[model samples]
Target: MSPSAVVNKRAVVVEPETTGHKNVKTKSVLLHRHIHYEPSTVVAAKGNYVELNSGQKILDATGGAAVSCLGHGNQRVKEAINRQLDQVAYCASLFFGSSAGEALAKELVDGTNGQMARAYIVCSGSEAMEATMKLARQYFLECAPAQPERVNFIARKESYHGTTLGGLSMSGHVGRRALFEPMLLGNVSRVSACNAYRGMKEGESTKEYVARLAQELDDEFVRLGPQTVCAFVAEPVVGAALGCVPAVPGYFQAMKAVCDKYGALLVFDEVMSGMGRSGTLHAWEQEGVVPDIETIGKGLGGGYAAVAGLLIGHRVIHVLDKGTGAFSHGHTYQGHPVACAAALEVQRIVREEGLVENARRMGEVLEKQLKERLSSHPNVGDIRGRGLFWGIELVRDKATKEPFDPKDGIAMALHEKGLEPKHSISLYPGTGTVDGKSGDHIMLAPAYNTTEADITLIVDRTTAAIEDFFAQRSYH
Candidate 1:
């Protein structure tokens, strides 16, 4: 098939026509996320590009949901994994502790400036959230006063935590929760997210808006009977749910105050925003607050392994250490040696190479380039983010900030268009940015080590993809 045909087909897998491989056209048995659209088969990935079987080398702008912080194929991480494998690939966390896990945990705790006392490593963001919920509940149970009645959790509307039942219960993403609402925990409730673009009223000062939000949170606690609340969960920088929206200055601080007043734990879900993706090592650092319980993932292993972790602050640690002296949770692969090794090395490289500083410097360039090139587009409603993480919200009417109909699939269409040979770029697309079901946004989270020239190429391709996507459609 020609490149044009491949582009027209939209995520169809292209079969090789070599004499030996001609008859290899077999239906895929592995259940893919999108059943109808067979994604292009990736042959190899290195640096910032993924080469597909169709001979297309696509630039990875979002790093596969912002996971690849170091980009792909880092020799240091590879060697670390190999070294861990040589010693032990997996160890039952309950029975034994591995050196890799110990080093990684120490690294994470140290990174937090000793503010966090312990680290519980897990396999994915969802698992980390699950562990976080269990740990928070346990902390309350083991507290000196033993507040077992503190069972409720409060999260923001239009936010995402994870896919697990506990995490999903805390999440406010409408589309993801629609089918599983019956199965979700009833104790969790939601308040408004800190979205200045939509939530801030006309002529409202940032201070006033923050005060209003804090009062809203305080009211929710009152409505739920503040004593019943266990935690107030939130992402320091909103990820896919709101399209990389950062909290307004002083927003998190106010929320933390409310949490403190109510004696509820403040849980920061940094699964997407942590690990230097947001310029700062921790997103909460910028907000001038430290969470009681924090989850870190995505960039932790830099796509070298499936890894995420929970960082426990001194308060939670003190309670747990004084009471049960044990966490009431365990996963079969809680601290997989290889994953820990990869993550430890990735963190080392991040610190040694000063990739965090690089992300901060490059983020400015990315932000400037994006605003200059695409901010004036008729369909571009808003551009917001920090560090290597950025998001572009698309709308039907820029004047009114009207999003396109959900059926239009505008964000995913832009994503697919970007993967076509002409564009050869990968963008992370998301819907439900405005509410939980009515907006479209594409996120860009390049690797931490991305160069200025890389930013130029990413912006060029991103601008072209957005332009070409809207150019082919009519609004009327």
Candidate 2:
């Protein structure tokens, strides 16, 4: 832990990973206005596939950035949505109650063994994250007679929450936070992620690595004056930022102990990893530890609706009910009936049809296929993930562990190439795996209902695309 030791550790650099395709069609719309153009238009979607305006059917390998968990089209979810539309599309949660919303909340709570007492639904993950922050603050104000000064949060570096101001404040993704750094709130601190593939030391065992991370968390709490630290926030399985990296064994337990010692809340941002993405109803269940507040989205509605929610633990609920008599926050669309209906049906399908178990089964097949096909590839650095979520970390040199230059756009090239008519596959591309500036990786979060044949197709297409990409690179 010496300064020299830290200095000796090479820092990862993240750079742009894009294809220099000049002739691609451009859009006149503002879009994510700040970012550049060349957008592809989707004409339609069905089951785990999407058809482009060009009439090509591309396999959705990453589930539209891991949002389409139940696949592109699900009749059950569609029928539920249509049924809710027939009943009521939107109902004001402020004064009125909707059966869809009530039923969904009850379902969520029941699924979690009633560990979650109350639910607050929102339109997107960012809203849920923002609500979580405010709720955590309110919990502190209402509970603990000491009038604690704990207003700070401790989150891991390279983590993402959302795009809203509060969510941005809690997020530690360097690229996402860079431009908005000046406007972000100043109540958050960061620690290293439990990224064993990159963060673990050469000789360290997984147990030792987890212990070290736990000690680091303890030290961070002490440095920040534990009494002033309100919550420790992290993604149970890191999503976009690190390519679906799960924590090492015992890591969560150690961190939970530290949080308990400091009387700080643990917030799990399961926006991408929850709702059976990691083979469990809740990712925390896999860790054998529960968070004081849990944010869930993405797979919740399975892309059938825009919905996200915060599952408030009993302790936080008790504190809020006692002090404020209500949560001191509200959004116009807090609990949209249609969204809840969609999510309810999605959850029901997952449980009734047994998609969680399917995710577990296919996830093993995926891991085996990936390792067998790409583990020894010179540029394939590390392959890691849980359940249906997985990432392939790409490096330039296998022995030296050097990453391809960001200027090379290796990951993006792979993605663009995969979209070619011959390849007919779509991949989620990522950069900055080495830090916030220099590495490349491709993430895969296939649909939970994916069949064995579908898995084989994906592996075949992905491997073929990768091989062709490398071949072209060698020629270049």
Candidate 3:
């Protein structure tokens, strides 16, 4: 039970059979990710672990896409959901206002200290992103002088907004966008991402790298015509693509400055890195620049419910307030009471227990543990992140920064191996990281309430699983 005892334990090095490529047969009724796949059926979950029907207890390392910030099966959140279910579980936002919805929105807006004036709750991050895009169009039309010429948006390359058509159109995630390109809108364009690991040029200072990225944004706006741009959108700390990459210092400020010069809004997609992921309630808080419109998800409800919201900055809210006094969009479940109540209590626990601060403190511990254990490894090209959200990029050649061939399927291999009987540790896998088509990495986003034991165990399990993987690989 002692902290030092926990940290000092020898790592459980899972064996090399963690390759996970048996071409196993399946009787699966559900079409899980792959064709007729039969993965371990998780029948129960508690705390940071899920139990399979085969009696395997897997450590929930990535929090199921970083959604279980409060950890699994939280009794308090369950109780809150029960309370809301008793009162009113469902109410159309178009017709009636639920107290849970209003109170949660008020609490969320209050957390922003009035930087954001309104909250438009939705069922998912993709929906919230679609809303942000649609609202941006309405905003320009409703602005003074009614500039209809503002029809284009500039988002960063390798960034992920969401999976819906509008969201896909706004996103430049090559892997995610490839299949949907034909159906996507053509108004959005992209510039370089603000990743210093691979983006920074040879012998370039951080200042020069940021300056060049800023210039790229400026050029993109110029190419699109300044008057035609409606907004410049990016994730403050990128998720999925490029693997937990945060912009260089002053990066957001510089990008915001360009948006300001072009009379365009600055949008931050915090769907994966917000709500206490990066040691702050909002990742933008650490960057020192507020976004004109921000979309948040994943941790918003702590996975207690499918919930996401658009946090409208004062500028955008003020424009809508003056012009329409009503948003032109709404869903049947725009502000579901049960979902709102779950998120509200989850956030309340976060605030009362000081979990965001815990994220900051524990993040340092996790980062240290990961680097100490994996940084010197040949394939671990880089280790980078903040708060509890971290990533380990795998490469074929470390010195040249050459990534493994996509056919190697390294990230997914580790992903599957982590779930093998001996390891039984869940990890988040990402592909097409270097260019949206050829990079491999494993993301680690644990709970904000993760304990020292959880951190140590995560690091240990991750080390074991990865080591088990590379041992059998002939990546030459």
Candidate 4:
């Protein structure tokens, strides 16, 4: 048998043969993202830990790409899901809508303080982003002037939007875009991301860095012919592509200024950073720049259901309302009732429990503990984040900020080491932190309601995992 077959065979666990005939367990036919090896079978999860079929309980620190904001198996969300299922599980959003979808959209719009006038629910971040792109294009067409020339988009480099083709076209993540480059649209262009650790020049003030980035964006708009640009897209806090890199202070404001100058919409893709992941309902709230169009997911459903939504600012809404009174794009599961209900309950729990504030408080403790435990380590080049989100960049030379060669797979190695029974932790790892081909970092995005003790455990296990990983290998 092949290596994958061997892994599949090992994954099977035969129950005790109580009957007269012998019983055998069947191998998993599920095609997981990772093809080379079978992933650990998670049998159960609760709070901050997930138990594998092997009975090894792993502490979930990253919340499965920062999706489980309220943690696993939330009773309230489960109940809400069942309630919606009993009432209306699914509906053709194009023809009919459910109370669950209406309530969720109203809550989302109100959460934005009316800045976002409408919410278009969808299945995932990719779908949300795809809708955002199409809406942007349609908005231009629907405008009084009918600027069909607006066909280009300006996005930041080293950012992740989503996985679909349109989302990929807007994303600047190199690895995710490499194989799909030929198939991606040509109208999308990229500017330097506001990554201070690596992008900020030595001796450069924060104001200067922000101004330079803003100018780069302005230049891109001018190069693309301002009239040809529909929007400038970015993540208020950069996610997986750069492993949770937050923008420098005044960064989003400056970017927004450039977009406004050219009459282009500002689109914030907050799939990973929104929905209280960064201690705020929307990441842009802290930046003081509300996006003209926004996409939110991941924590929006808190992993209870597959859901995301597009928040349309008044500017875009007015154009579409006045011109066509209809959005041209639609998905079959656009307003999934079960998903909306689950997300609504998750938001309710987050608000009632004051979990966002808790995330803010616990984030401080997590940062302090992480720095205290790992800052002095030679391989740890930088630790940065906001709220419950953070990343630790691994470097070969701390003094020079030299990233380990991509061939080393340092991030993946550390992630694997973290899963070892002794460490018993789950870490989110990312590569191409330096550019699109090099650099390594591990991310931590604990649940919004993570406590001080949980933070301590997380930091302890994380520190041990890092130390053990480095100890097993030598670099000169």
Candidate 5:
């Protein structure tokens, strides 16, 4: 029953099999080719690693797409879930409120300088984003005395929000949105992202670049007649699509100013960059700007539970509370008691154990190690990121900064090579960093509790994998 006793117990580490790959031949019951044709069958996981059925222990460098922030098998989160289940596992938010849900919402809202006074819990980041979009729309309707024509949303190109229809409409990732283009809503418009690596001009000053972007945003609003734009959605730190690209100084302020001038709500998609992944509890905090709405997931539950939420700022909440007295969205499993309890405990542990500070400390180490290891490599283009969230952009030529052809599948190859037995690392791979087609990059977001040894292991294994992959290509 004691927390110290639980900490003393060793976690069960699943080992890979020495036998030949049998799972590969076995037809999977689930739809397997959703992302890739052949995916690794993870037998088990603990701490900051996952064991594949192939008998390889992979250092989860990307935290399973940057989801597992607290790592695996945290006893406290597990205990919280058990306790919540005993009390109440599920309660409809419409009928009655659950303690676990109420506490989790309070913790999230209170942690963020009270910028967010209302929290809407959901099962995934995509769901949270959908709710955010709906909330933004509803807020506009409530505030506008007359039925306002502000139904349009402005989102940056190459940015990803979620997979659902509404979220997809707000997203501009070409590849992910291509198939769903016909079905996507028509209320969304695209703008350029603040990706300094790719978008910044070669000789442009940072201030000039930010100003130019601000002008572009203003121009877009003008083109759409400012009042037609309801919300401008963006990720404070561009994740997956651009590979951990943070906006340059004055970028967010400029964007926020534009939104404010046009009377459009500012929404931050912090699903991948929030909950201490970006050194700050909220990614927007680092930019010195606050958003009307913010969506957080992944690290919110620290991978101990499936939970995501949309944090509504006081301004937006006030409008809704005064008008409709309720949000126009609902999910069957919204604020599931067990998930809330697990996430609440995970967040508490993150705060109590000083993991956020640890993330900031280790982030410096990670940056140093990465720069030392790969900065001068011929194929390595640019290394950029902040806090513990980092990305290494790959190019065919460092001088020209030309990206490898998408046909080469360079990012996928690097990911596969990292997962090989000789290397055994789990990396997050991304493509289309350059013009949404030519560039490739890998993201590294190791667990916050990782030690220096873990950092060294990650760098070593990553270096070896890239070297081996290039070496084989040279031979070929």
Candidate 6:
């Protein structure tokens, strides 16, 4: 590869990729996050290890935003995609449906054990969220009595839905929404998140906290006019936006009660925390509340294919079934046959191999290791999550719970250092920009099939990375 090369007879500037995203290093014709950053080049990958062209092997801990559940180069899924290609690869979703798509959708619906009535497969998490947002509006119109005024959406602060305009409007993530504030839909209002570390009053008990949070949601609905509210969108276990914060005991039940009282739909955005990443097949199952409309991605296809889906509850399906008899939204690539086949194969393995149980069991080991090692660190403020999903909040002063100054760039530094040659382990990190909070957070979302030994290696390398980051900062 030269600094300037042309395949299509055009000039191109080639530069190394940024180490900011897992030691990426390469020159390519793609628009990366930062124009001057270069990351390592991945030559190959097997199981949980990714190989770089420079011969460095990296332990994949975060699974690339918690995707890649089946790990790298899964032969079964590869064969499934190849088989689908031999038959039919692409088909217009609006005009026809393939057995591949139908089979995958049936599997998803059956996985819910009939709780979810229909499945609409899409290409990515953002698109799934964008679809669900539109579907909610359409659903109301198709209801027995059309409620056109039901446009207001209530979402919690410190939550992320997606990056598209509609998804951005529903999300409370600070940085991503700043650039499009003027253009984002203003119908979504935010309330306090169910984060116990930040939201709990000094003397409040768990029961009291639940009640207070529920009251806050009810109040928001009332303020917005109950009949005007469309839905309350949230991640059962908040994802990158809040760094894997799981709502406390009785949290979802309480929230659902509020939604029921107001006749607003309850939507769970399980893109990051669903599909066995959090031990259970669906994170909402653990919360004891089923969403009216659920959006899932990332782990859904396990990075074997581009796939995400919307799971509609029985009520929503019935309403639409009785009315217009069709959903008025879709993408060009909706229900792509090859993608569905790949996802279906990936899911089959996840179920047959018992990876969900492994995630639950290994999650205990992973969490215990993190707490035992870092809970006493001066900068460590909190450790909270469920199953394989965990997050560590880094504060400058644990006593005061004060976050490090934003200019310190602590989160990205910790992330980059963890992926260095010595560490050779990939991790996830969050700043105030992504999480809508004033602190640094590091997320550990390893593959669902990870072992005790893998967990141990991750913890050891990560602890060293944290210590090194702080020590180097002290020297400065």
Alpha carbon lDDT at 17, candidate 3: 16
TM-score of model 5 relative to the true fold? 0.93
Q: What's each prediction's clash count?
A: 0, 7, 0, 0, 2, 11
lDDT of 5 by residue, 1-476 (tens): 00000000122111111111222553556654231123667898999888877777988898887878889888888889999989988888889889999899999998897777888889999999888877777887899483367789999987889878988888877766665689999989988999887888889999999999999999999998887888999999888888899999989999999999988899999999899999888888889899999999988998777899988898888887789798888989999999999999989988899998898899999999999998988888888887789998988888888888767767767877787788888767787788765678888999888888889999999888877887787522
TM-scores for all candidates: the values are 0.94, 0.93, 0.94, 0.94, 0.93, 0.94
lDDT of 2: 0.83
Q: Would you give me the overall lDDT of model 1? A: 0.87
RMSD score of candidate 2 (Å): 5.0
Instruction: Give candidate 3's whole-model lDDT.
Output: 0.85
Candidate 2 pairs with clashing backbones: 12-434, 13-437, 13-438, 14-437, 14-438, 15-437, 150-228
For residues 101-162, could you state the per-residue lDDT of candidate 1 as single tens digits?
99999999999998899999998998998898888889899987899998899999988898
Error of 2 at 126 (Å): 0.9
Q: Mind sharing the TM-score for model 2? A: 0.93
The C-alpha lDDT values of all candidates are 0.87, 0.83, 0.85, 0.84, 0.82, 0.83
Identify the leading candidate in terms of lDDT: 1
lDDT of 4 at 395: 95
Better of 2 and 3 by TM-score: 3
Q: How many clashes does the backbone of model 4 have? A: 0
Worst 10 residues of 1 by lDDT: 1-10
Mark the 10 consecutive residues where model 6 has the least summed lDDT.
1-10
Q: What is the C-alpha RMSD of each candidate to the true structure, in Å?
A: 5.2, 5.0, 6.4, 6.1, 7.1, 5.4
Ten-residue region with minimum lDDT total, candidate 2:
1-10
Candidate 6 per-residue lDDT, tens place, 336-447, comes to 9998999899889999999999999999999999999999988888988888999988888888788877666677668778878988877677766224635678888888
Clashing pairs in 5: 16-55, 17-55
